[model samples]
Target: MSYMDFPSFSLVGSFYTDPSTMDNDPSHYDESCTNPSPWQDPGGSHFFSFQDILASKPNRAFTPPVVTCAFDQNGNPSLTDPLIGAPVNSTDTPGATNGQTPPFSPAKMVDLDVYQQGVSNIYGFVLKLTVGGTVLTGAMDPCTLNSIRFDRVLPTRGWAGWDSYGWGSFGGDSNACGVYQSVVRIPADTWPAASGSPILDQLRAATTQDTSGNLLLSIRMTLDGYQNVPWHASDFRIGRVLATVGPQLATDPSHCLAGRWLAGRSAGPGDAWDQPSLYGAPFEVKNNTVAIDLSNALMTSAPGQGPLNLGNLSVYIGDGSTGVVGTPFQTNDILYSLSGGIVRLPLTAEQAAAAASAPFFLASSLPGINGLSTFNKQPVLWQESATGFWIACDDRNFQLASDQPNPGSQPGFFYVTQWGQPVTDASQIEHHVFPCFPNNSAATVPWSGGYKGNSLSSDGCLEAVLCPGTHSGQFCLELSAIWDPGSRTPELESQLYFICLWQKGTPPPPPNLESGCPPQEQMMSAVVWSSYQINTKPDWAEIQRLMKVYVKLFPSMHARMDLSDQQTFQIFSTNPPWFVSYANMPGPATYTLPSGGVIASGTIPYYMTRTIDDPRLMPIMRDLSPNRLLTVLYYCYNLQQETQPTPPPPGEGAPHPTATPTRKGANA
Candidate 1:
């Protein structure tokens, strides 16, 4: 509906003469109350008060464009007043009980009787009380002993009249008295002629007089008591009529009826509560605080070839701008306006490419350890070997045998043929199997064989073997090329040999030659060296420094190694002076070798006691010594035993464990 052609009030024939004109003359009782006498008083009697008129004769008493007041019947004044000298028991009183004495004493006098009489006479012309089609007579004014008898007049039309009252006659002067007031009770015909007719029909015909004395038919309405008006009709419209005739307090806009022209529909899913949609269209209405879901909209004519092409296309809607277009898609793909509206764009090749190629990489580090060390310090290496070549050596002392008769007999090692191990030459051994031992036991050993010393150099061949120890049941081998310092040439290098065993028997054969191998070199520049003593562990700072250097060499590899010694507890009944010394000595000792490299040793002194038979100390010695003694035995065998002196017997000058100090070569 365009504003210019909007319907007007008169188009539907909803016009009527002012309500004031209807009640202009009250003297002509037989005619409709279209014109009441101007000299009549509009106040003084209860009828002059619109409230009393409504209470006395409710329903259609007053027509459209009527002023009304609400009154309480409970507060009505008495008809007789003994204090006023009006006969308290007089049967002549209009409302008195027949032949009965009044409730109050006759000696007292009340002024209300006179006052009510004056009000009734002055307002008699304007007020009318009706019951059904007939008007009652001799109805005593409840406010006084005065009698109010109406001329048996029946209203022909629906109530239509005016009201007036004289204050001077009722003992109040012009200043306090109201005069020349008019009211018109219009017939129900003045209502809307049709369902959708203009709402001003009853208002225009029934009431008149504006606050500015404009003489327009618009009524100054002030809504008060409950009037049985229809739901569609607004209280404001009714109030305007009353306000035009009398003073009225302005009402808040929110309190006004929800008119169609005043407010649009409430916010909802498809309403303008959100920003208007702007897609292949031109302009858009903006609205903040709204949300939109544009998952499945299509843009066909964009910078791409597909029918649902979403490509480079500048679109703006409600403070939002989109550079790319999207084709028919789900809620996620649909473009949303800045203010909150969904829009679809055509699909383009660029968008397709963007969706296809997303940069992602699989990144991982060594498991178990944390921080950067797991990534930087753990070493990973690959290798190649020749057939028949034994890649590892398993010493008999470090291996377990079923029987003691062959305790020293070697159980042979295996070749590396699995997990990235390849045999390229005739001397390259493909596979070899051997018994396994506990990984943590001193007897457990890794696969170790190198073709009998210089044979590796002569035959130009390589072999690998695995010894799966009992404790750790997995075998791992890594080999890398080491660079020759003088020739700057790469040669086959042994990186590491790891063996874990599940049972006592031989391990399975290695994989075929198709397995990959590491690059061959003389000496590997990158290597991770880590060691921990029985009592001392590397702190984070030391680990970090080592990790820094390790990362630089093996920029892309992880290297890790953990080492521990068996724990030993020694107790003495008579504490030795150097008990702390022996215990402290057991902690791992780190030192810088002559080669400018670092090494750690797991060794400690055995403290001696005068009373070695203490029962508590016995079990402690037993539990803490067995594994430690085994480790010491292995160390002694490897380095050629050079015993440390026994500790001096308490106060006896016996040799102390530290009495003897032995030093072995670098190999030890």
Candidate 2:
């Protein structure tokens, strides 16, 4: 026999009073089956009343609940009980030798060692009592079993501590009747009911599925016999019920298979991809073996089904990478074309379960092209389209320095493949990538990107600034491909351009350009990195309005800048040295302002400007209000040219970039 280590499954055990069938005895509080604290109790009776265990009250004779099991004349446990914990018609015989049943364990909390290697399904546990009639059996629904969370076992206190207040004795009553239960919380509610002599008084089970859909099973047991049982009165009165619930592994091959499966169509050739083309039905993984039926679409006998066209099928093994292209299977990746559409992977149940959650990134070679050809080499970068699918383009032959749009460039085929599916010609080679932005648009203007000429990068790139005429919460895509003015070869490239979204009342961008243009890029970058939107507005009046919104969102960036009549007028003076100059103040410089000054600065680096070359800043500040003038300073301050550190002599340590003494703003 070999041992395999499976993921640990939790088995929660608890006890609760059944108000309908059992009496509501306030004294019968939740208690543990195994209490360490020494307490006086009758011999062979660990069921000490709550008053004796907790309050040191006089000990009372009490019988703990247990499942009734039959015994033979030889004093050996017997499985003669017709309604054992196993399912109906189950041929499972744990004690086949000499008709002796497995000995019952007295503890309420028991560890169940479930073997998933050869097992298909697990029926309910088999619980037997040390002293009782032939049988006591019943099955409770998963919801009802999981709800009984009393007498829960704690690491420090085994079934001792109660997390809930209601589980304790209520209404000034003190009866010590311990409630013991263990159940699995799973999705199913169809638990088999009891069908035998001496119906079980209490039986609960709960189970939950792991990330891989494996069952974390648990069981609960409660026995009731002998009269005056402080907790409640049961309708069935039997002899002394001395019993305990123990673990019994019941395996059934007729039940549903264990573990999960992820299935999808194999990648098809780009030129002949078809959505209705049947490849295989939903597959199942049993014992780490998967069998996909190919007769459905392959066999001509099946109605309306075409002959099975065997294509390359592969299973995705994401080797710690993300995104489509980066994670796509290379020549080294595992490729599978199961024999007769049936293949078994060498993975344990736990490993197989984890694989089901990830989307399959199937890669297929173009028709007529060698599967391992150089041009068939996977593209270096794959930008996931807005449609949540991937579109592959081959630009190996095209030559260009800057990545930009070249509309009408080449009539190459681009593949649109879904997650975990193979690319076929029917779904591959498409002119459009995404539907018109907002999805409800009348015309479908697919936006494309990641090419040369109208690249997403590069200053003044046409695709970078594309936007719709109107703005709303939904996204819109525009064809940002600028037609070749000189008709320099009809190969113009086009890409989907996501319209730049901006906050309401944002200042208009530079004239003769896209509305939001590059400002929205800076705004979005700042918001994503530091949650601060640096002033990018060019108009002084509009800047004031944008500042109001920014100040409301981030009050900490708010700062007051009061300027005097002389300071206010001379602040923008670059020729004559004013009271504040970049030459004198290398760092933040402060200037005293007269009362009632209208300069309000917030979070903007307080740098005095000596020269203003930026087109956004006006040479003269006399025509502008103090607030508008400050706004110009705020915008220019952030626009300072990013300086790179100069290298030292070869083999010497690199020197840091020297700080420029003149605080001059760069041209936008």
Candidate 3:
């Protein structure tokens, strides 16, 4: 008594009966059953079985990484640090001395790679046994249920006209490969259709690589009552590999642009250039910084995909310094207007968002090579190359502002700006004020007290000068660095130059009711300083000889002038001299000479005291159209000297007495 009868073994019965059915069905065709049937098990029950040969989300992430961190200053684990703040000396360990600084602060790194979980829905099978009239434990207990089929397949793949190849691979994107959905009528089976139920509830596929790195796809099937089954929707709707492509790059522009960069500490009328050049054009230096006008680099339709996103774009500065040696400076791109080509980029500084809303030099305390404080400013040439997925577009001179440079050494500021001269291979300009001009140090680093009441007696030699100003004059310090086209050497030799000078106004008597004073005493202060640093000490004999001929001729050097300390080569002069009391003229007064010795006091008449060594200063009666000469504003004042009970030694700034006759008072 074999279970399957000959008549039942034909079409439907043969399709229904397989070794899988026999293995999954317990007590199949048992003779001791209450109802003698070949389809019934030993307990007069039937069995239901489902098998899946495959299962996939092509773009799904299998896992998100977990992170570990140390306690921050705030001690809150959840409050993540943005990691873009001023650096702290992390090397400041326990009991470290004050003001201790670490060698460097290395940037933190992050893992950007993701391990793609390869596909895995190979095969799966489900089997359940049940009596025709018996109730099962629950819906989850599929081991004892009646035979069932989908009401109507969903995720509907349409194959109405064709009978041959019905599968379609249609949803591929950059991140992952698409699915192969097929619509084939389930082979006419003996199982009954479970109508009104979610026949095709959901379908998903995933992709991964095997030990050999061959990609495998996986998918799962789900219905209303029975919600999960392993069925891959690969190109075969089974676990299979995916085909992918790699990436490429872009190049530089031959004829891209040109413009000026206008930035620095001093950028106004008659000052250094306010707009510096971008396409290697020549501009002027202002406040130790250079600005290039990139208005020409402006474009409506960006070269690449879309409008330039400055947040995603990195800025580089290409000076003559690093491009020849690699390692260009990576500056922060300030802003690229969404609608215009006005791209403004600031160099060398960081944590820009945290900086206060003041000028860079005023807001920050970082110092350049000069002892005076300065913010980062490195002039550069903008290149146009790309590295991997990003663009490499800047070359910089690191000598200007390196990480831990010598205290007073200026950063290398090699640019290709022509000062009305020919450009060469080593065509360079190193300046403190931007575009490229050596700084006028006196105004930049004003003396502790004003220059008017100061002395040359301070420990070091001081170089000072006077420039014409609105009222009196301004004392300025000058650095001598020649602009040499042949080489990049410091201008260290002696040279002759002139500086316009100024003098303080007369100090009023008690109650100090001085007001409405006009511009006074416009003159030239001759400067003679030695920059010869040939040895550890200066050559006093050679220096003093040159200085004495010019400077000792003036009254400022009445005290000893020593250039032994190379640091103090500066020769200061201003008039009517510092540390002198100006006297008030009390009109014309008559006085009698004394038989006994007694110095008499007399009022010097008020009149313009003019001295002309050269005939070039001719006063024009009227304004000339293009005036070759400047009409200097003249202020009038009377010169009156106060009598000192005890005069300074004749060697110490006392004027040599003149034998001219004058009125003397009679006291004896």
Candidate 4:
């Protein structure tokens, strides 16, 4: 049997044989019940004793060796030592020839048993081992065999050291020397090596079309460890640890699949994830029907209908009521529908009650349909019927009816309704009526003395007057008359002529003396007053009267008259007349009449001529008194007497009775 070390005594009693009930115990079992006794079977298929089993298993027990490790000056383990004995070098020998050192030299021993025993006694036994490329050394208690490390490097890359181990000189003693051992185990796998490669590969292939194929092969190995692991149960929390790491590892691939998953699900026969149908289809109840998919039916049909068949239903998914139909009944309407199927329109209670109570069709006809009555007994027909409906007379109808008038007879008055008579063509209706004149026919005369009845002579003096021989007269008449009978009117004669008449001779004068008259009396005749009629035919005086009338008729008329010397008797009517007197005087005539009816004749003496100069005369000779007329005649007589020359008598050489030179006093 192998020796076993019992560290904790709680497991010790199983090794010894039991004293009681020995006959039935395995140690006391019959030889027949045991194969090769209780410890052995034909092929060792029997239960092994605890000690034998311990001996057969690989040595899991750690026994510290008596190690006397020595340090060199650099604090490394030394090969040679004086007090502790040298390590035995297997290559060295004990006996040698020619003074060569022995293989097992006493001073250079590779295995120093004596020093090792001394080391065990001095401190404690210690064990040294190498694991995962790191060296660990531990001291053990002599009784407990438990480890107390002085210097060790763990497989996880942690270190421990002691103050007495020379690790102080290496600057590790302060950190390593503690009651709790400072042990660092180098990890078998690093985070970067385990996770970085897979993560990076997934990220790189995330854009590839065959990411699923690539990712499946790549990630299968990392996840396989948890294939049979139960949730929330493991030593060292391996499953939990893997679970935590799994999501981190899957972040890239999971993110890549997210968009594709959403797109694929959205492209199926259902509403997109972001939208929903608001109305659903009607339900059909039938026997033998199982459950129905309302979500799909809700998507495909109108609201208020439900329980449709799953095959006929569509997926309803999205934000709530996005595709809702039926005019979205208001909250009030919805409440009303829930209560009952009655819809209340927006009518007020009063209006509804009034409408319910009133008789229908009583006021149905339009307003103002009745015929309107005027103040008189006439009906105004303010409303009229068009087809079957009556229309009130609006302002347009009233205005039209007001404008209508009755036909009436035309009055005898000129009415200008259209264009006026054309003033431009008025000359066609013009008439040349004979314009009447006073004292003359309306006959046109030629330039000569005959009447052409159409033309008037240019020389004829025509006066257009308004005197009509009656009150209102004709206008613009021409008259032809001789101006002077003595010669042709001076205006008509261009030449000047002289005329000579016979003068009385003194011969045989006067029939040889008159009765009792003196010889001189017979010769010089007394002045006799003879009335010579100035035959002014065609009566220029009358013409003058007519001209005066003309001037009165037309205030703008003015004329100038000229008379010849031979026609001295021509009367002129002017406010003031210019007169000439023949006296051998250089000035105008001045005469004073004598009182009483006396006639005196004499040549105007030079002394009396001054008295007669510049005499004032009345404009109308008839207006003068007889005394004044006598005075004028007396002046003429006096002027004749004064200028008389002695003439020879009739037979005695005196002037003849009628030959006194006509007693011309002064030509005025």
Candidate 5:
């Protein structure tokens, strides 16, 4: 959707038509209402939705829309002094409440009611209640409004007709004169760019005020309890506009943060409220704030960069140009680079608008927590639009772990809340108690992996139900891989669960075992491969033994491994064969000898048969040993143990125990 389509209201600075004073229209009354109206509206001319009109709070009285106030012969609005229990259409006080008191009271002091709840992606208002007052000058929390209410109303069928489409409620301490600034959140793409753009000054200027700086007649009456305003209040001054950068806010303090709301995707498999998906924790970005601190937000790490860490991020703002070759992707308006983990954005109105309406991204040159380092450019995938940015899961080489049979089979990429390990038992998997986003329905994929299909199916979008869970005793795969890096060393660790496994049901069984070695021989080959095998051609008997061993491990691995079209291992092949690590093998890699002289890189393949004939391999043979084959894997496991993220403190129960008899090999 175009950024201009965002949902927002511009102030004309007018007062709302009083609901209590409106004439009765029975056709607009909902049948479920305690008291239905008597008249029918054949043309649907009634302003408010029947249900909304009928569902007035018990503390408030319901009224219908009618021409209670019309232009006088002189074209002035008919006026009346404030009077308690005044009647509508009263000859003496026309358009007054029809013997029913309005919910507001002018005598009571009216102040902006600020809710301090956490932020969210839902569209909301942040009005500057009072310019300089102690209570009014602060920012109103947009996260307070729980939900939006939409109703159809036609007021003159013009600009005013756009006024009261959505309604929302906040349950908390509120006085008769307290004014709430509720947000009617729509999807970020549908919301008006003004919601987060530099249109605040223009909107604030649009509001009409009296000579003494007080609001005009209509707003004064509404705030004074003469009328109850429904829908977007055009005259309200929006507070410093803020939006989220990711799909959701983390509510648990132990994991990321709580009470700091971010607005992003409300639909998708990863949008579980309690267990935030691995797209990372959502964070806030506000307009006109000059500098933004992203150390606490999820903006640091991009796809392939691995998990974020302090002092490693570089921030960039898109220049509002279609990305093309030879064109600069980033804007020079970034006055300050990331320092102390904060990025200073352009402060001017025009620059800020261009920056927000275009793409915004973060890049880091440092190696990620996974220990993989790359020299390729990390592309920008997010646009800091009016409300929030979008995030797409990059499954790397592990597409089968997603709901799709392969990449591109469906829409959205799956986001794993837990990775690298299995949940172990059914009871250990945390269930989404309130809602579950439907699989394959996502906005966009920020970065490309193997996922190529883009079918935004409206049908299976956001589903609110109990998510699927695994039954006890079911086996799941946890595949790990080494990404394409500039270099791979024994000091670096391999990424575990590079593709999160499908953990919701019984794992698919291994392929049928081919004619091969006996069980005892198979066990020996498996032990050799895991503990001592080097990258070399094995004997014919050993090849059969390895095949037999793979039979035990391939089932779990087949669904989790991202390989070429070939589904089976190449154990019998004479070409470069697979091993835990090729470090001890000779290949394109250059090596420095113990004498401090470097061995020029080899052009020959690394397998025992392939490299034995290459004269350049003579020097490296001195370093080759059965023990060297295990060193790389041993160090990788050690680094993984040292770098594991600290487990969150125990909750209400004992931590789940890990299961045994883990799967092995390419396929079993």
Candidate 6:
């Protein structure tokens, strides 16, 4: 939607009008209202004093279009005595009950009466309340040198119809009071800049006026009460304004901040975030903040750079002509170049309107977070604005585990979460998960190894749900990738339901959370992280032998293996693949290292977080997932360990308690 087209009376300011016609371009402008009106409007118009009009809290009986007071036949307004409950309009005025009258007693106090709440692309918008008129021609008392300075209104930014009180601009008589009226002429463009520039070179403001001659901006703030004009208010202030660089303030005065709130978006799949699809996916849009992986375009260790860190990359959006180089409007005039690649420069629609070129750039440091080494940083993907998400500055990490020591090793679930790994959303497993566990050398050719086999359907859960499966054993994958830079080794882990597999109707034995894998309680269980061999490739012959033997061992188990999923890029092609440390065996990659082979690229990195530990959640396992982990272990990977792993370190559960099959390639 063209968000600018949105209509709202949310802002207030002053504009210009032709004094001769008494018409204003921007209608409904009202202002400061400190005193009561004493002089008649002379035009015989309905009258309401400024202070009486705003006496109520707002949204009360005083519907604040505020009655205009009549000017005396001489144009001079008098502030003699305070007028109370003077017939505002013939039919309205709320009265206080219980004999408890309020100060200067307003008819009523409105509760959130006119301030509506809703999302708007437009932020930091300014408006006018009333347009003052200029002294075109008027009768006057003879002017002395002291009378030279008159109370005549003058034009602002040029427009006799809508003007400001000029300095030494008014002339003619001192008592000079004549018919006060002006022609209405709204600006062709509502924004200060008809072009809608993202950066404001200057403060755009307006002045509100009350019949008592008090001029205010008419800004409505919950706290600090209704401040008089000339004082810096939160939303519209001339002095130190109050505002956050983040999204629009939900409450009245949270963000009167100077920095603009920018948008974010994913550059593409080439910039895969290091975490697995199950969790820690670099892409997120929440609380008006956007986070997307930008590794492809800015990774220091990317193709040619060796061991170099970008040191908080900088990403940009907008024309870049007027904004200070490397500074986010969100920042209180702080320079971005000062922030190591951590802080993000948010781009807003206003900036877009005045953009000179495509506004897209990367940052080395994430915005807000500071003072940290970037070596172990999770492929830094701060706010990618297109989504309008908000990530607190203090919430970002300062340090992480170093490069993977053994890129092929599986670092159990316990170790993974211990180091503060990010978790992925479950529903996107197939689209965002699975591809991380591709077939290592066993597939004979890396080109076809990444999920291109004939045994199972060639899709993840996104397609798995579409593929026909046994009604009783249907399951979806839920797995995680744990990378411990201490070992420079990363392992893919899966859950174990083979231990709990039984006929659909019969309930399994009580879960043993103390030892072995946690109990699988639901029909649709998550894909527990598991691997065939921690650091080596499984032979196809050995895989076939294991699969055949398992099927023969449990003839009615109806186990199925899916091999095509091991193929990298089957679901999505991205740069800096999920495995940033390891090289692809014989697949597409930006760099091919003679020592490590291929660096996996062009994919997502993050797996879903398992909910086995939450006491309140006991999903019926049989209904949610397919019987696929075993088939995966037999045909695609080798089980990590024979005995159930015990302790804070996640060890593997036995393949089966009763059987030990023979395979020459098997270590056990």
Choose the strongest candidate by lDDT: 2
Off by over 4 Å in 4: 1-464, 467-641, 644-668
lDDT of 3 by residue, 1-668 (tens): 00000000000000000111111111211223223222111111011112111114463211111111111212122213221111111111111123443122111111000000111011011111121322111111001000011111111222232311112112111112111111111111212232111111000011122344322211111111111111312212111111110110111110111112222121112222222112211122222222332322211121111222211222332322111121222212222111111222333333232111111111112222121222144321233211101110011111111111111121111112122112232212111121111222211111232222111221122222212212111112232222211111111111112121111222321111122111111111111122221121223344343233212121222233332332233221112221122122211111111211212221111110111110111110011101011101000010112222324333655433322121100000
What is candidate 5's lDDT per residue for 332-373, written digit by digit as tens?
A: 112111121223333345545544444344433433222112
After superposing candidate 3, which stretches have Cα over 4 Å from the reference?
A: 1-260, 264-413, 417-668
Using lDDT as the yardstick, the better of models 4 and 5 is 5
Worst 10 residues of 6 by lDDT: 111-120
* Model 3 residue 523 CA deviation in Å: 26
Over 4 Å off, model 5: 1-128, 132-202, 206-309, 316-361, 365-368, 371-668
Ranking under lDDT, best-scoring first?
2, 5, 6, 1, 3, 4
lDDT of 6 by residue, 13-110 (tens): 11111111011100111122212231111111111122223233333222222212211212222232111111211111111223533122111111
Give all candidates' CA lDDT scores. 0.19, 0.23, 0.17, 0.17, 0.21, 0.20
Return the TM-score for each candidate structure: 0.14, 0.18, 0.14, 0.09, 0.19, 0.18
Report the lDDT of model 2 for residue 442: 18
Residue 238 Cα positional deviation in candidate 4, in Å, after optimal superposition: 99
On residues 1-668, what C-alpha lDDT tens digit does candidate 1 reach at each position? Answer: 00001110100000010111111111222123223332222211111122212224333233232212211122122222111111101111111133443221011011111001111111111121222232212211111111111101111221222211111122111111100112212222322233221222222232333343221221111111221222212220111112211111111010111011000011113222111111111111112111111111122111111122222223211111222233222211123111011232333444323322221011112232121111123211101121211222111011111111111112322222221122223232223211111121111111131111111121211122333522211222222112211110011111112222221233432321112111110011111011112212223343233223212222111121111211121111112323223333321222222222222222222211111111111111111112222233233222211233334435755322221211100011
10 residues in a row with least lDDT, candidate 3: 6-15
What are the root-mean-square deviations of the candidates from the true structure over C-alphas? 50.7, 31.1, 44.1, 83.3, 33.0, 34.0
Which wins on lDDT, candidate 1 or candidate 4?
1
Better candidate by TM-score, 2 or 4: 2
Q: What is the Cα root-mean-square deviation between model 4 and the actual structure? A: 83.3
Candidate 1 lDDT at 661 equals 17
Compute the lDDT for candidate 4. 0.17
